[model samples]
Target: MVSAFAITRFASGLISGTLVDKFGERAVFSSGVFMVALFTFLAGLSQSYEQLLFFRAAGGLGSSMFSVAAGSVILRSVDDANRGRAQSVYQGSFLLGGIAGPAIGGLLSVISLRAPFFVYSGLLLCSGMVAFFFLKGDKIGKEDKNADISEHTTVREALAMKPYRIALVLSFIGAWVFFGLRASILPIFVTEELNSTTAVVGYGLALSAVVQGVILLKAGRYSDEKGRRAASIIGAQVVLLGVLLLTFSVNFWMFLLSMAVLGFGGAFISITPASIVGDVIKGKGGKVIAIFQMAGDAGMMVGPIIIGAVSDLFSYRAAFGMSAAIFVIALVLVYQIPETRNVEGPQVKNLRPLDEDL
Candidate 1:
């Protein structure tokens, strides 16, 4: 089941941005949200494992579309100075949903196995409608369609820029540790290493989500007003500290403290990459956004397998240490990228034509 979702996400991530470029952010984003809602509802109705997997895969594809198109719209709509803050708000909404969904699902599960899925489907559809109506001026209007398409930068052109490359690397590393290991390995670490209960794990995650929500507001403003490099470096170092603390944690309290630190790091890490891309792109950057999303998705898919292997071969401490090492590497890369906040570059000009090759 996990593999089906992961594989589909990775695959969809590659093309979703192109779809955004060809159609429009409003269309693609709304459609993706609607697809997710529809497929999730279908999944709930499935009686067989095969049918469930199919629906889950479809949901993954929908997620890919939603992420890429939403990111493109957010980046393009905001000015250079406010891009960081804009991304923060977008990311915060997702985190808020993550926090709410599990609690709602848990409650609904008591009524029936499929009740939560049906309810969530309705919620997603409502979100889609909101996106369709509220995300104004993102679609290339009929009068400007040809000119907009001509002005948009292709994936190849985006790759030639240094900031995009740096952002991609940071995103891949961030997703690997924050989404992959945190979701899959942390619970095991709490249970086996700290001799804690699932309730403790749940509380720790809930606490982290709350902290992340609060800190993201400050982090986004800091990145916009200060500099992306500085904010990202701080974020990576903080995450490394959290990983180090988690590596040595022996008690439930220590584990909870580490979760708080990790949450703080997540505040900076989650939105920085997308904002950086916004810094580098001139206009609708569908292909570049798609590639960036794909890198993060790939990391999420791969991180668990690597962490699990490390835990099996050595120990859970070793797995945690490996994650810390990855953060340190990301920190070094963050330092190498030039500061993008409030700085104008060639990429800030009108979008260029597509490279003939791609």
Candidate 2:
């Protein structure tokens, strides 16, 4: 648990983004998938936990590499008008993975923990091969080699953009609450607080995931027409309500309701942030995006460690309540950030020439 994904998942965005920016998406993705495929297979062969961590870390880097590079590639490949739908599909994959992994892991765990590793490897290897052949549109090779994207745009710049900064901070806080509950506190709530059976908790989680998946689909389209800020306001409230349910839940019905609400709110946070970052990294697609993805990974990494630690020493109720506080922070930050819906400014026209339209 300590080494399986925590360290590796943390570094995915930065490493992947840099590779994409430097080498290009097709190459980076191919290399990343190959890494995951190789290590996942090797992880299955390993007999010790330490060895598993090493293998998993390698795979995590590869997986993250694909995300950073590929995400940027998708954004840059399309026009602003199509980004919302594109982001929906991309971000939806995460929730899909979260949903599928446990099911696959469960089925495979019956055979052995190593079983899933081999399965993951083969899948990545197949994807890597496909990307190598099908990515005919990559412009990385054609762009200015000494592009000002890297030198001029810094983390400070990202922070300086009020909207970007708000997005980043809110992303961090949102991740803190979302992941902290799943990793540190949810099981405790089920077993100790609710006296729920293991199967019940599993089913509850599955249902919530399904709800989140639906929300992502619907909200993506909704946010495309409405401002992202509007989606965020409603999303924050949904999560706030979900957290409250978890804290005050008295029965299985309440627990189920909390999960659904949590899923609903969480979906908006996931969908909006990706598109927002895409907007910020308009020109230097890969490099700027890498920084953004890295910041997100850093937040996800730090959240459980800090929040979980606090929860471990204190009560479960307090841990959940604390997570809600983080959501509130996200809400406030989102409020301050300027909405990018229907970008209407002179700066935008000048920044991106309509050289091509998707």
Candidate 3:
């Protein structure tokens, strides 16, 4: 059952991104969360381990489905003028969720494990309502004769683009560095080195989210005007520095401070990649967003396993040390990659009657 959870999660992300293009974000995002709430509630009533396992996998599917749809909504709804900031707020909402989910879950558990299920349902229902009203998509424009909408690229075509190819690899590294350490192995470092408790861990993580959210809000605006590459390069270097600092710091207060620095690095996660890929795609918003997300999931899967194994052989410090190396590689990659804004926007011209392609 434990293994099934991981298996389902990885698979779900891949499919979710693709599906978003066809359905549009509103229906896709709303229904995905609704499904999870329903299935999870059913899981609570499960009498056997088999039933619970099925529900767990179902929930994973629901979660990724939501990711795919919501990303598309944000990408398409906001114009180029405000995309970075809009997405920053969209992502910051997740920081809010990250805060509420565990706090409410732990609180509800005091009353009953089942109590959290009801809370999850309510939160999702409210979120779905907002999206249903505010989220808009020009799905029909993709089919319009006069719009000059470009045809969607196949996965192969997306991969063949040199800049996009680099974006994919960097995205993987970003997701790996940001998320991989949180679950199976890195928490050990937090507890042992910091000697903190449940409340402390919760607060520490929340602090990161809060700090990162603010930084992202400001950074997103800069990315839009100055260029996304600058934001990413700065963020990557901070993360690398944070990782290095984590290795050397022994004091509890120092540990807390370093986590904030790590949070500073986390600010670039969504804004950087989205801006980069968005620049490359120009008009094909949904497809490029999907491609960017796929790279993130790839990183999430690969980074943890490798880091965890390294930790087993060496130490958490060593694990983070390796992550530092990866971060350096990310910095190098990001630095070398061309700034999307620096490139000219595609030229639009009506084809002449004499032109053979016409």
Candidate 4:
């Protein structure tokens, strides 16, 4: 049942970028968040598994649209110097919600299992209203409100850019290891390998989120002020070290420490790639952002099943070690990619040449 949501979300991610380009960001973002609110309300009212599945998938669809459009809007709104900060704030808000929502939902569940969904629906609706009214009516850097989509760069052209491709690859590996494998399998690893209680595992996960949130603002600033390249390289190395530590950790404290380190690394990874893409793509970022997001979604979809198979075949340690190897690959990719933060406005034009037919 959960798989249905993941699958649909993945599919939505693939096409949502195009939709963002065709429709403006404000319209798409507002509509998407509203859809999420509506579907979540429906989900809470669902009487059967089938109805639940349908609503959940719909919610995923809305979520994909919201993510792409929101990112595009952020990139469009900010100058290059503040792009990192903008993305950091956007991602930080998400992390804040992740940390808070579960706690609130747990409390709501005590009242009724369906209560969280309904409350979340209301919250999403409120957010949608805020987006509709607060987001400036003008397109990102443009004077004309009704410019044709054909004036912007196409999806094909965005993917062809070297820096964009590198960012996309890193997003995939990061998602595969962080969201897919570590998030799903780490608790099991803690219980099985470290002989820890589920409560301890919960604490460790929460600790990571707290640490990630604390560092997100600084990390984003570093990417902007220092350089996107520096942030990516340091983040990849830290994540690799953390994953390696987890692989060899024999006790709870060691595992907890590793999660803390990973929290910082995750903050770096979350902020820099989008910052890099935003630097290179000046106009509508729908296609490029969508492709980057799609890669991450693909990783999220595929990583756990494959890593779980590896764990079954050998051991959990081997599975974690495999993840460390992925971080290593990400490090190499980040290293090879050029620094995009300092690219000038003229460079942006040259980077993504306009496709008249687009």
Best by lDDT: 1
Roughly what TM-score does model 3 have, to 2 decimal places?
0.86
TM-scores across all candidates? 0.93, 0.89, 0.86, 0.92
The 0-to-1 C-alpha lDDT of every candidate, in the order given, reads 0.84, 0.72, 0.70, 0.82
**Model 2, 4-99: lDDT tens per residue?**
565675655665655665678778877777887898889889989788778877777887777776776776665555566677787778778878
Clashes of each: 0, 1, 0, 1
Lowest lDDT 10-residue stretch of candidate 1: 138-147
lDDT of 3: 0.70
The order by descending TM-score is 1, 4, 2, 3
**Candidate 2, superposed: residue stretches over 4 Å from native:** 1-4, 9-15, 138-143, 146-156, 343-358
Model with the higher lDDT, candidate 2 or 3 = 2
**Which of 2 and 3 is ahead in TM-score?**
2
Candidate 4 overall lDDT versus native: 0.82
Winner of 2 and 4 under lDDT: 4
Model 4, 140-191: lDDT tens digits are: 3223344545556677877778888888888888888888666678889999
**Higher-ranked by lDDT: 1 or 4:** 1
lDDT of 3 at 217: 86
1 against 3, candidate with superior TM-score: 1
Candidate 3 per-residue lDDT, tens place, 1-358, comes to 6445555656766576655655556777777878777877777777798998998778878777777677665654555556677768877888887877787799899998778877777777777777667665454122334434444555566667766777787788877877776655656777776676655566667777888977978877776666777877888888888778877767656666777888888787557776566555533345556657767877777888898899889988889888888888888887877766533432222121244335
